[model samples]
Each structure stands twice: as structure tokens, then as C-alpha cells.
Target: MIKYCIMILAFIVTGTTSAFAAETAVLQDAVTQTNINYVWTILAAILVFFMQAGFALLEAGFSRSKNAVNIIMKNFMDVGAGGLVFFAVGFALMFGTTAGGWIGTDGFFLTGIEGQDQTWTWAFFIFQAVFAATAATIVSGAVAERTKFTGYLVFSILITGVIYPVFGSWAWGGLFNGSGWLEGLGFIDFAGSTVVHSVGGWAALAGALVVGPRVGKYDDQGNPVHIPGHSLPFAALGVFILWFGWFGFNAGSTTVGDTSIALIAMNTFLAAGAGATFSMIVTWFQFGKPDAPMTINGVLAGLVGITAGCANLSPGFAIITGAIAGIIVVYASEWLETFVDDPVGAIAVHGVCGAWGTLAAGLFDTTAGLFGTQGFDPSIIGVQLLGIAAAFLWTFTVSYILFNIIKSTVGLRVNGELEAKGLDLHEHDNRAYPEFVGSDEFIEGEV
Candidate 1:
């Protein structure tokens, strides 16, 4: 009897010890994963943050000499304003607890986000915040010479705080919480094709529509005029900066530093190179000269186009996708100029190419990709179409309403005299180059 009792006690002790060991192991794993996720998330956030510089240079280079300072200011203010607004409410609305499959409810002010597997959630918001800012800045270029600075600031806040987060919630937020229709439909936008680019593109379209054409941009006959930007070197440098940042823009969307990132980075590089190469060739063939601006825009268009499908496609497929995007950007920019006077090609690069990228995801996703691995149905093409339509309708309608409201109440455009005199002098009371001030000959002839 004594021997049997001893044996039973031993068994009980061993079982308890084993349970403790298992619990410790689970906790360790959770902690390690949390740390790893934090590091990767922060890194991606930094990369996306650097993209603001790329945007600043791009917009400054694209605008006329009279609007350089104004462009730079708009870019600077957008980052500041958008970042604050997004942190305050946008993050919650985008990634918080769900509502009726449309918006998020919980997480307001990032409250109670601790100890949760919120690494992905935080990183996603930061990266997406930069993209929202990018979209807002695109309109700055389109309305560079004409928009009121205060009015533009208000628009940026509304977009980042409400417009962008609302639509973004529909796609990524819904997917994160497992209630999104997109997941049920097997829709895959590994990054933000419709989420980021399309949202921005639609907003740009609305702003351009409301702001009207720049002075002398269209003749009385409605023919478009050529308003060349003042600085090609600046523009070229801006393109290079944007290209460099796009590595982070596309590859960083993976949100993790794993072997998959290697594939994504390779695909991104191939697409961008193919875009620039194809655009250069197309320009030489079609326009009788290799246009520098077209080449730059082509690269951007390709980058934007491939962003949706970067992780899903092979390098070769990326090249083809990017090349087509490059060609489309060239023609689309010209075509849009006829109807909407987007001075900086935002409509072409972000709008038209953004649509192409979202659709391309449906075409190029393969068995090796995320969709195939998950046994998601092949009806993703139709789902992608739905996402595109939803993005277009929601973004256009909301943005148009906001812009019209702003126009009727506060007015959207500056006076023509202020536009011709330049916003640096009239809006801010400072000149980017003070030496040239008070000289009409330099203002009229040199510019």
C-alpha cells in the first residue's frame, strides 16, 4: 500500500511539472513573436515614412517655377496634418472593432491596443497613413497654382481622417477582422491597389474637376496648351527618389522580413525597370523623341500598377505588367489632359494605372501565390471588379460631395491675379528665390 501511494504521488508531480513547462513554452513563443513583429513593423513604417521626401521632390519638380515653394509647403503640411489626424481617429476607424461590414468602431484613439497581436495592426496603419498623404499631395500638384492653402489643408485632414479610412476599412480592416466581404469573395489585394492608389486617384479627379483648369491651360477653342515645368533636373531627381522609395512601397507591404520579401523586392525592381525602359522606347516611337517626363511617369505608373500583384507574380510577369502600365500612363496622361487638366499627371499615374493594377491582380495570381495557397476560389476576378467599382463609386461620390461643399461655402480656388502672381508671394508673403522678386522681366520672361 505504501509503495502504491508513493508511485501515485510521483505521477501527479510529473504531470504538474509537464503542464508548467508547456505553459512556459507557449508564453515564450508569444513573446518572441511579438518582438519580431514589432521590429519588422517599425522598419516598414520607417520605409514608408521616407516616401514623403520622394513626394515632395516629385511635386516640386513637376510644378512651375512660380509654384515651387507652394508645392513644397503643401507636401510638408500634408505629412504633418495627415499623420496627426490618422493617429487620432483614422487608425481606430480602419483597424478597430467592426460595424456592419462598412466601418470600424472600437480602437478609438488607439485605446486599449496593448498586449494584443497588434503589431500588424499598427504597422498597417502607419504604412497606409503615408499612402493617404501621398494621395492628398497628388491633388496639390494638380491644383498647384490655384488652390487656397487653407482650403487644401482642410481637404487633407478630411481625406486622411474620414474619406481614406472609410474605404480602407472596407478592404483591409474587414479582412483583418474576418468579416470582410472581400475575404468571402476571395479577393486579394496583397497591398493596396484599390485601397490606396484608387482612393487618391479619385480624390485628385474631384479636386481637378472643382478647381478648374489652370490659367492659359486651355484655349477658347478648348484645345490644351503646353505648360512645361521649369526644372527638368529637379524632376529627374524626383523620379529617382520615387523609384528608390517604391522598393519600400511595394516590398514593404509584405509587412514581414521573410523569404517572400526577397521575391517581392525582385518583382518590384523588374517592374520598375521594365516600365522605364518600355516608356522610353514608346516615347521615342510615338512622340518622335524620348520624353524625359513621360519616362519618369511611366516608371511611376508601372510601380503603381505592379503594387497590387507584386507578391503574386514572377519577375517576368512583373516586367510585362509594368511595361504595359508604362505605355498606358503615356497615353492616359494625354487623354486626361483633354478633359480634366491635371497639370502633374496624377490622374494618369495614380488613377488610370491604379485601376489597371487592381485588375491585374485577378489575372496574374497563380498557384504559388497567397490566393492559391489558401484554396480561395478563382472568382477573384469578379471580386476584384467589385472592389474596383466600390472604390470608384464611394471615393468619387464622397470626394465630390466634400469638394462641392467646400466650394460653395469657402471657395476652392485662389483669385486669378494671385495665381499669376504666384502663391509664394500672395499666399505666404515670401519668395522661394527672393533675388528675382520685384523684377517683372524675370517674372514674365525668365519663368
Candidate 2:
């Protein structure tokens, strides 16, 4: 009896120790994963933040040198303004408790979040905040050189604070806790092809239209004219910057530390490569030379095109999607020129390609696509179409109204005199390159 009691006591002690060990291991894993997620998210935010510099350079390069300072100012202001307004007002509208599946009604000023979620909230907000700024900046390129500084700032505030978040609520509100109608319908835009890119694209389209064509962009017969950018090298560098940043933009959407990042990164690379290659080939054949601007835009088009499906697409399909987007961007850029003066092809790269990417997700997603064992879910396609359509219409209409308001109240463009002389001198009272400010060749040719 004594021996048996001793054995039982030993078994109990061992079992308790084992349980304690298991609990400790689980807690350790949880802590480690949380730390890893925090690092990943912050890193991604930094990468996306770098895209601002890329936009500044690209806009400056595409625009005349006289407007370079103005371009830089606009890009800088948009980020500052976007970050603040998005934090104060946009985050709540997007991620708060849902109201009838359309909008968020709570969590304003990031109130009421506590404990575990609070740890996640800060890093996630910054990541998404950068994305909001990105959407706002896309319009800067489309309306470059002539948009009023004040008017542009106002639009940026409204877009990041109200316009972006409302739509974001409908699709991405569920990411944290609240559910959206589109999410209910099973819409999948893993990295926001429609949510970020398309919304920006459509808003850009509206701004470009309301702002009207730039001076000297059309002839007496309304024939299109070519106003060359200041520096192709700068433009190329900007494209490289944006390309590098996009890996973070797409892969980081995973928002966790996991093996999936490898696949996401590879898919993004393949798509960009295919896009650049196709654009080069098409431009060579169509224009009898590989156009530098077209090629750069092609790279961006691919990045935007794959964003929606990056998490879901196979690498081979990513290549196809990106290559098609590259070809489409060339044609879309040319086609849009006939109707509107888009200085930097923002409409093609973001708006048109954004729509295509979102829709392509429905077609190419392995789990829900025609290629899958389930053999094509029409409902997924329907949801994607509805989401894309809704984004385009909502953003364009709101943007048009907002632009008109800005136009009527404060004026949208600089006077023709200011535009011709350049925005740097008239708007900012400074020149980007002071040494060449008044040089004859600089004013007439470089400017």
C-alpha cells in the first residue's frame, strides 16, 4: 500500500509539471508571434511610407522643372494632411463597428479599444494610414502643375478622412471585427485593388476632368500634343522606388509572420517583371521604340494590377495578369489622351488597371476560380463586379462634387499666366533650381 501511494503521488506530480510546461510553451509562442507580427507590420508601413518620395520624384520628373518645387510641396502636404486626418477621423469610419453593413459607427478617435486588440491597433493603423496617403497622392500626379495648393489640400483631407474610409468600411471593416455587406457577399480584394487603387484611380479621373486639360496640351483642332517631362532618369528612379515599396504593400497585407510571405513576394516580383517586359515589347512594336515613360508606367500598372489578387493568385497567373495590365496600360494611356489630359497616366495605372485586377481576382483565385476543383463560383465574380462598380461610382461621383465645390468656392487651377510661368514662382514664391530660374533656355525649353 505504501509503494502504491508513492507511485500515484509521482504520477500526479509529473502530470502537473507536464501541464505547466505545455502552458508555458503556448504562452511563449503567442508572445513570439505577436512580436513578429508587430515587426512585420511596422516594416511594411515604413516601406509604403517611402512611396511618397517616389511620387514626388515621378511628378517632378514628368512635370516641367518650373513646377518641380510645387510638385514636391503637394506630395509632402498630402502625406502630412492625410496621416493626421486619417488618424483623427478615417480610422473610425473604416474599422469601427458597422452600421447596416455600409459604414462604421463607433471607435472614433480610436476610443474603446483595449487589451490584446490595442496592441494590434497601433501598428495596423499606421500601415493602413500610409495606404490612405498613397491613395491621396495618386491624384497629385494626375492634376500636377496647375492645381491650386489650397484646393488640393482640401481634397486630400476629404478623401482620406471621409471618401476613402466610407468605402473602406464596406469592404474592409470586417478585418478587425465589424462585417460589411460586400464581405457578407464574399468579395475578396486581399490587398485593395478596388479599395485603394480603384478608389484613387476614379477620384483621379474625376479631378483630371474637372481641372480640364493643361495649357498647350491641345491644339486649335483639339488635337493632342506632347509636353515632355523634365527628367526621364528621375522618372525611372521613381519607378524603381515604387516597385521596391510594392513588395511591402502586397506581401505585408498578410499582416503576420508566416511562410505565405515568400509566395506573395515571388508573385509580386513575377508580375512586375512580366509587366515590364510586355510593355517594352509592345511599345517597341507600336511606337518603333521602347518609350521610357510608357515602360515605367507599365511597371506601376503591373503592381496595381496584381494587388487585389496577390494573396490568392499563383505565380504563373500573376505573370499573366501583370503582362496583360502592361499592355492595357499602353492602350489605356493612349486612349484616355483622346478624351482627357492625364499628365502621368494615373487613370490607366490605377483606375482602369485597378478594376481589372479586382475582377481578375474572381477569375484567377485558386480556391474560388474556374481553375479550381470547385469549378468557378459565379457568386464570387458577381460580388467582385459589384464591389468594383460601387467603388468607381461612389468615388467618381463624390470626387466630382467635391472638385466642383472647390472649383466654385476657392478655384481649382492657377490662372493661365501662373500656369505658363510655372507654379513654383507663382504659388510658392521660389524656384526648384534657382540657378536656372531666369535662364532663357531654362524658361523656354527646360521649364
Candidate 3:
């Protein structure tokens, strides 16, 4: 009887242990969370990809009808060609193993990345690939209607595969190896104001410089001449599309599906609203009209401004940041137009505002901001300035050289005939509006 009782007790304990182990295994599989992250990140990437349509419509609408097809083609090609080049070389340079905290030296052609549940490598690639294309496409607008499609293609490949990725490695290398000097010094740029927008903005400035302004952009006395877009409705629609996509742009940077997404999304909304309101008010008071172009750009400026600290800033601060960005876009656009001929206001909205947003992260960050829990850390501000300076210098100098090279080698600008005739026919042999072909109705100097 004693032996039998001992055996029964052993069986009960063993059975109970086995049941608990099985339940724990089921829970672990259910809550692994990596698969969920992959899905969220991919969805965000899809939204960002939709922004390419926004950019195409925005640039096409802002430009002459004759150049609309060319603009659309360039935007389309950038996504295709830019993605391949970034996947082939840029991703490796950006996210591979680090060398001295400056660059990555592995994963070329995407060879070495592997995992079971952490199969996020591909999803991450798509997200970052869209971002890479965004930086390259910004140049299309600044040099629109005048650039050679072939030359522009080369520029796009180089920017995505080399210039942009190198700088991205400097600031974001930690994502791969925890080995970037800027990150080591606690320099935080939450979503890439400097990384994406400023880099694109500076490159756009360089391209504009190389290609020169569009025909009739400036008069004999060097005063800018107003060249209205073909359709304000299209431009407005593009702005709205961009606004919608930006929620993913900011919130998706979290790289996970979590509660913080709600806060980030709200902050994004507030800043964009503030930016639009303040810019409209400023333009209404200054120009005697609520300028539609400036107002649309102001909304973008606010989006770019708040991107850096969207996760770290409060709703009120986000509004202040965006409102200031809106106001700044007006002044910066006017100021840049005095010398540089940026047709789309890319310089002001992305480059200058991007830098400001990056620095604003230092001032308003809740966790490590100057006024955050740690309180009064001047070093964060210093680091932010350093990051901004580094971004401007690196992006500008390299891009200027690249543009010059492309200009001298394959030629950056089309012939003046092509400029007057419209790139749609000259470059693509296609017309966005075929009915106006061979008619003086769409000519540069005509009504």
C-alpha cells in the first residue's frame, strides 16, 4: 500500500508539471510579438510608399502642364531605380556591421541577415527603402522642367546608394551595432528630420544650383517672376495626401505596434494643424492674401518640423514647433528665392525646417530634453547643433560635387529649346495633356 501511494503521488506531480510546461509554451508562441511587429512595420512602409504618389502629383501640379509627364516619370523611376540601388549597396552601407562608428561594411546585396522570428530584415528594408527614395525625389522638384532625365537618374542612384546612406550610418548606425558616435554622445533624432528631409533639401539646393533656374524664372534685374502652377486643386490634393501619409512616417518610426503610436499620431495632427493655421495667418497678413502655395508648403513645413520629436514632444509643444515652422517656411522661402531658384520651396520646407526640427528635439524632448526629467542638460543642445552642422556640411559638399560631376559628364540641364518646349515632349515624347500639343496655348510667354 505504501509503495502504491508513493507511485500515485509521483504520477500526479509529473502530470501537473507537464501540463504547466505546455501552457507556458502556448503563451510564449502567442505573445512572441515579432510577427506582429513585422506586420505593423510593413503596413507603415506601404503608407510611406503612397507618399510617392503625393510627391508626383505635387511636383506635377506645381510645374507647367508641359512638364507634367516628365515629372511623373521621374518620380516613378526614382522609386524603382532607387529601391534597387539602395537594396544592392545602400542598405549594406547603412545597416551592416559598423567600422569605427562611421559606416557599415557588411551585408552587401543583402547576404548575411537571417533569423527565425526576427525575420524583420525584409520589412525594415522596405520601410527604409521608401525613405531613401524620398530623399532622392526631393531633388526632382528643385530641378524640375530643366533636368535631363538620364542625368537625374544617375543622381538618384548615387544619392540613395551612397551619399544619403553614409550620413544615415553616422547617426543611425546604432540600429545595427550600437556603435555610432553621435548616438554614443546621446544625440537623438527620433525620426529623421535631418536624416531624410534635410539631406534631400540640401541635395535639392545643390541640384538647383547646378541646373540653374527654369526659363523665365528670373528677370533681367534678377528679380524672381511669378510662375503659377497649372492646377491648385491638384496641389491641394497632393498636400492632403502627404498629410495622411505622414502619420505613418512619424508613428511608424517606432518600428512596433504599441500604445505610444496614439500619442505620436496626436502630436503629428496638432503640429500640422498649427502649421497650416499660422502660415495662413502670416501669409494673409503679409501678402494681403492667404497664399495657397505658401499655405500648402507651410503645412509641409510643420510636418517636417515635428517629425524629429514627434514621439518625445507634448501636444502643446508640437503645435508651437509646427506654428514656428509654418512661419519660418514663409521667410525662408522668400529669402532663398532671392538667390536660389527653388520652384517647389523644397529648400525651406525640408532643409532649413528639417534642421530646426532636429534641434527642436533637443529643446523639447520629454525624456532627455533640456527641460525634461533630467532637466537643464546643455550637452543635448550642443550635440543637436553638432548633428545639424554635420548633416548640412556633409550633404551639401558631397551633393555639390556629385551634381557638378553629372553636369560636366552627361550634362545636368537640357538645351534651352527643351526648356521652352517643355520636358514632356523632349524627354519622354509624351504629353500629360496631349490636346495642348503644338499649340501656343501652353507656351511659356503666352496666356
Candidate 4:
């Protein structure tokens, strides 16, 4: 009897210990996940911040050697000056509490937020600050080579501190403490296809229009004159760097460490692959050669195009979105050549493709899109269009007015003498390649 009692007591003790161990494991997992999320967010923000280097190299490569230093300076200032503006007023305007959902009202200089999670707040701030800088830097390429440095700086401040933040509040305000009108309406921009890219692109369009083309971008017959950059290799390297960094750009938007990131990263790369393939084919058929510039730009178009739907669409649909964007960029560039002199095709890759991506998010959504059982919801499509139209109107109008203001006040374009001598030498008293600048291959006369 004593032996029987002893065996029964042992079984009960073993079962209770097992259950206690299981409960402890669950709590440990919860704590571990929280730490993982913090680490992931910081790492992702770093990746996005590194993209400034890619932009600098890409813009410098597309421009003449004489303007390389100027391009680098613009990108350098984009991170430095733009970051300060975002810290002071831009972050508040984008993420602060507001009644109308039009702008943020608090959180300026990242103060008074100590009541919330301090670690999370600063991580989020740095991530978004880099994004604001990115939107400002896009204009540099569009208005390169001829824009006055002071004028560009002024525009950059306005964009980061006011213009980009307003639009960002409308779309991504809910990401922090604010709520956006567009987000309330269910606009789907997973990683800023419309909020960042289109806003930047439209602003770029205005700046390009106001700054005008380079000195000899066209002839008396109004035909585009080819002005090749000094180094294609530099441009290619920049593209690769941007591609690598984009994994964080899309996946990191989740603001968490989870399994969903695998899908987002996969979708990002697939779209890029499709974009490059389709762009090469189109360019090959049109030019009897696969043009490197268009092909590289096609990669960016795909990245911009899939950004809106990256989290919503299947892998197959991601490819379709990117492939279509690739085609659109080729024709868009050709169309712009006749009127707009976009030095790097920023407007087409970001603005037009951003609209397309936003629409694609609605069309390819897992539940309500065309591939879904209901075969796409017209309501979603309408909302997407509305958001796109709203972005264009708001950004273009403000940017156009701002650019005009700069033009009238501090001068937007450099003078003819500075143009011929190259901006590096005259504006900055600097030269990227002093040995190779004697050949001003493209600067003939003002357009």
C-alpha cells in the first residue's frame, strides 16, 4: 500500500512540473519577441539611411564629371539639413495629434513624448527622418547641373519641413500618434508608393519645369541632344546598392519582427526581377540594343511600383505590376524627352509608376482585387484614384509655387557664365575630377 501511494504521488508531481515548465516557456517567448522587434527596427532603419549613398553615386554618375561634387553635396545635405528640419517640425507635422487629420499638431523636436515608449519613439523618428530626406533628395536629380545651391537648399527645407510632412500625415499619420484622412479612407501604400515617391516625383516635376533644362539639352529644332554621363559603372553600382537597401524599405514598414517579412522581401525581389527583364526586352526591341540607362531605371520603376502593393499582392501579381511599370517607364521617358528634360527620369519612375502601384494595390488585393473571388471592388479602385489625384494636386501646386518663389527671390538656375564653367568650379569652388573637366561636352548654349 505504501509503495502504491508513493507511485501515485510521483506521477502527480511529474505532471505538475511539466505544466509549470510549459507556462514558463510561453512567457520567455513573449519577452524574447519584444526584444527581437526592437533590434529589427533599428537594423532596418540603418539600411534605409544607407540609401543616401546610393542616391549620391547614382546622381553623380548621371551628371557630367564637373557636376559630380555638386551632386554629392546635395545628397550629403539632404541627410544632414533635412534630418534637422524633420526633427524640429516635420516629424510633428507628420505624426503629431490633429483634429482635422490634415496635419500633425505636436511632437516637435521629439519632445514631450517621454510618456510613451522612449526606445520605440527614437527608432521610429530616425526611420521617418531618413524617409523625409529621401523625398527631398529626389528633386536634386531632376534639377541637377543648373540649379543654384542656395535655391535647392531652400526647396529641400520646405519639402522636408512642410510639403512632404503634410502629405505624409494624410497617408501614414496613423503609423504614429496621428490619423490621416487617406488612411481613414483605407488607402493602401505599404511603403510609400504614393506618399513618398509620388509626392517627391510631383515636386520634382515642378522643380524641373521651373529650373528648366540644362544649357544645351535641346537644339534649335527642339530635339533632345544626347548627353551621356562620364561613368556608367558608377550608376550601375549605385543601382545595386539601392536594390540591396530596398529590402529594409519595404519589409521594415511592418515595424515588427515576424514571419511576414519573408513574404515582403520575396515579393520585393521578384518585382525587381520582372521589371529588369521587361525593361530590357522593351528597350532591345525599340533601340535594337538593351540600353543600360533605361534598364537601370526600370529596376527603380519596379521597386516604386511594387511598394504600394508589396504587402497586399501575391508573388505572381507583384511581377505583373513591376512588368507593367517597366513598360510604362520606357514610353514615359520618350514622351518627356520632347518637353521635360528630366536628367534622371525621376518623375516617370516615381510619379507615374507610383500612381500605377497604388492602383495595382486595389486591383491585386488578396480579397477585394481582381484576382479575388469578388473580382475586384470598384470602391477600392475609386479610393485609390482619389488618393493619387489628391497627391498630385497638393504636391504639384505647392511645389510649383515654391519653386517660383525661389526663382524670383534667390534665383533658381545658375547664370550662363556659371553654366558654361560648370557648377562645381564656380558654385562650390570644387571639382570632382579636376583632370578630366576641360571637356565640357554638353554645355553649348542656354535653352
Q: Candidate 4, residues 1-447: lDDT per residue as tens digits?
A: 999999999999999999999999999999899788888888888888888888888888888888888899899888899999999999999998865989999899998753468778988998898889889888889999899999999999999999999999999998999999999999999998999899999999999998998988999999999888778888888888888888888998887999999888998899888888899899999999999999998999899999999998999999999999999999998898788888888999889998999999999998898777667688898889999999999999999999999999998998776886788876798778756645673343442
Q: Candidate 2, which segments miss by more than 4 Å at Cα?
A: 114-116, 438-447
Write down the TM-score for model 1.
0.88
**Clash count per candidate:** 0, 0, 0, 0
lDDT of 1 at 185: 64
lDDT of 2 by residue, 263-378 (tens): 88988898888888898899999889988898899898889999999988988899999999999999999999998888888999999999998988889988878686567888
lDDT of each: 0.78, 0.88, 0.87, 0.89
Model 1 over residues 104-214: C-alpha lDDT tens digits? Answer: 776766676543465566666677678777767766776677888888888888888888888777787753542455545666677776788878888889888988888
Per-residue lDDT of 413 in model 4: 91
Shift in Å, residue 321, candidate 1: 1.0
* Candidate 4 whole-model C-alpha lDDT, 0 to 1: 0.89
- Mark the regions of model 4 whose C-alpha exceeds 4 Å error after superposition: 1-24, 441-447
**List of clashing residue pairs for candidate 4:** none
Clashing pairs in 3: none
- Put the candidates in TM-score order, highest first: 2, 4, 3, 1
Q: Which ten residues in a row have the lowest lDDT in candidate 4?
A: 438-447
lDDT of 3 by residue, 338-378 (tens): 88888788999999999989988889988767668877778
lDDT of 2 at 246: 90
